[model samples]
Target: MTAILKTEHLSHRYASTWAIRDINIEIAQSGIVGLLGSNGAGKSTTMNIICGVLNQTEGNVFINGIDLRKNPEEAKKQIGFLPQNPPLYTDLTIDEYLTFCAHLRLIEKNKIRSAVEEAKERCSLGHFSTRLIKNLSGGYRQRVGIAQAIIHKPKLVVMDEPTNGLDPNQLIEARKLIRDIAIEHSVLLSSHILSEINLLCKEIIMIESGRMVFSDSMDAFNNYVQSKAILLRMDNPPAKTEIVKVPGVTQVDVLSEKQYRVYFDGSPEEVTDRLITASVEQGWKIKEIGPDKGLLDDVFKQLSSQSPQ
Candidate 1:
């Protein structure tokens, strides 16, 4: 499928320092793609450029095959953007606010009402249409922000930190809303929350110090760090030397008196069976054992540490 959004050699500069350099990304016609980075990692700068809020010093942005630089107005019409802090009029009622947004997006005057209603329903705001924007909870206000964004039915929705500042329940609701938005329009969202990204995004693009470090499907990202490592807990843990003596054991990390992280070569199942047999024969009471899928935090740390300043 053709990409709904694409950026090539995308770079931005602020006087002397480059905020983002030679960044490239592509999004398919549907699915949620995550943009991840630490603070000052240029995620905001990159999103701003893609949304046409900021012009790049170099490189190009294309939306639905329309060159953004040459045809900004046309390109922008195909995008729906929700910034970290949503742009909203506090005094306006939900109904009034969404109607205004519909008109602002140039929807036909005769069709604006239906468009606003549809957006409201999609964002689960059917009951709060008459409520004042400032009177709703944070989650409802976010729904209003999303309602305005999709009122015009743009091809791609770009949300920056959509789940920020929400309680646990609110976060769950927000995540569902985002997934609903992705059903019809492709999504590109920036987030620092790795677990949120892991749950929502089918693909991830990670940058550090303004440079691309990782970009791939979530499955591939997970598989990238797959290793023959196991977490073990025993009532009578053996010395590291005894554990290393087991065939296929390459390394061992003693996490605590009762726990260790063992690394090995060869099939995990076979190695695990061997270890179990040895533990039983040596009278080491096994408490627990499981494969250790390396953590996402570890991967992020490794990548970020390697990125140039």
Candidate 2:
């Protein structure tokens, strides 16, 4: 399938400092893809370039196969954007605001009402249509922001921190709404929440200091770190020396009196099986044995720490 969005050698410079450098990205026809990075990591710069909010100092951006620089109007017609703060008219009622947005997107006068109504329905804002935007809660305001974005049914939707500042209940509602929106539009979401990204994104692109650090499927990222380690728990633990003697065991660290982290160099299952057998032979009653998960946090920390200042 052709990518709905692509960026090549993308970079942005502010006077003497480079905010982002040599970044490249491609989003397949559909699915939610995450853009992850620390604060000031160039995520905003990259998103702005793709959305045509900020022109890149270098490289090319293609939205639905149209060069963004060469044909900005046509390219942008395929994109819908919700910035960190939703651009909303506080005095306008929800229905009025969305109608104005539809008109701004150049929807025909005959179709604007249906388009506005459809957007309101999709965003669960049908009941709030008569309410002023300034009177809505943060969550409801976000819903209005999203409604405006999809008013034209763009092929790609870019959202920056859509869940920021939301309370627990609101966060849950927002996540469901974003997932619902993804069913019809390819989503490019930037967030600092790793767990949220893990839940919502099929593919992840991580950047640091304006440079790409990791890009691949979420499964691949999990597997990359999981293949090298195992978590072992025992009721009667053995000495570290004896534990390391197990076949394929390369390193052993005692996490606690009865828990250990075993690093190995062979197939995880084979190595884990060998360790279990060795423990059994030594009368170390096994309590639990499983692959060491929770590597995403570590990976993010490691990459972010290594990024140039």
Candidate 3:
């Protein structure tokens, strides 16, 4: 697949502290790419640099092979961004605000009205098109921001925390809108909501404390997590001490009075037999044995917390 955006060893700083460093990322064309991390994890920083909102102190950014530092105008023309806070003029009606956006993009005057109307319709803002932005709900405000982002029909869209404060219904609508736009435009979206990222993105890039940890498809991430689990469900519960002491097992948790989850730090090859022997030796009956979901969550937590070395 073609790359819509590429960064080579991108680095950025705030005074003496670096927000992200030596990061390389490739965003595939016309797909949803997620930048997933906790707040202060450098996701927003990366997005800002890519959009030319912030100049990287080092490294290169290529939007469709146009180096941002070399041709900012042409590079920026290919991107539309929805910031965490939608920059709407609350006093202006949706139509009026969208018109202003069209003008900023240098759209031809004759087609501006029709274009704004089309954008409003696409975001389902037809009914509220004449209402002041302040009168719109938080969700509607976001739609207005999205409408403005795409008013120029850019090839790539970058959104920062797009669904931060939405109700369930609004979240659904926002997701649908993202899906609709993604069919024609590549998107780099940021969110702490892992589920939303998992559902919408074909690829996920994670950053922490100003560094890229890893980036891969969902299947690869799942496989990495699964390989870390040593599924252990016993026919009967064993003593907590024994369960914890079993070779290779790192931790234990009671699933129920009759069930327990065992975690292993080493290979799972001998864990099943070891668990069975430990149970039988102690006069405990073995029940069903399988890895637990918490195991994967633990693995993810461990990996995500460690700065990339």
Among the numbered candidates, top TM-score falls to 1
- Candidate 3: lDDT over CA atoms? 0.85
| TM-score list, all predictions | 0.83, 0.81, 0.79
Model 1, stretches more than 4 Å misplaced? 227-294
Candidate lDDT (C-alpha), each: 0.91, 0.90, 0.85
**Which stretches in model 3 have alpha-carbon errors above 4 Å?**
227-296
> Could you give me the TM-score of model 3 versus the true structure?
0.79
Q: Give the winner by lDDT.
A: 1
* Candidate 1 backbone collisions, by pair: none
Window of ten residues with lowest summed lDDT in model 3: 291-300
Candidate 2: list runs displaced more than 4 Å. 227-293, 305-309
Clashing residue pairs in candidate 3 are 19-210, 231-290, 231-291, 232-290, 233-288, 233-289, 233-290, 234-287, 235-286, 235-287
RMSD of each: 4.5, 4.7, 5.6
Select the stronger candidate by TM-score from 1 and 3.
1
What is candidate 2's CA lDDT for residue 160?
97
- Against the true structure, candidate 1 has what lDDT? 0.91
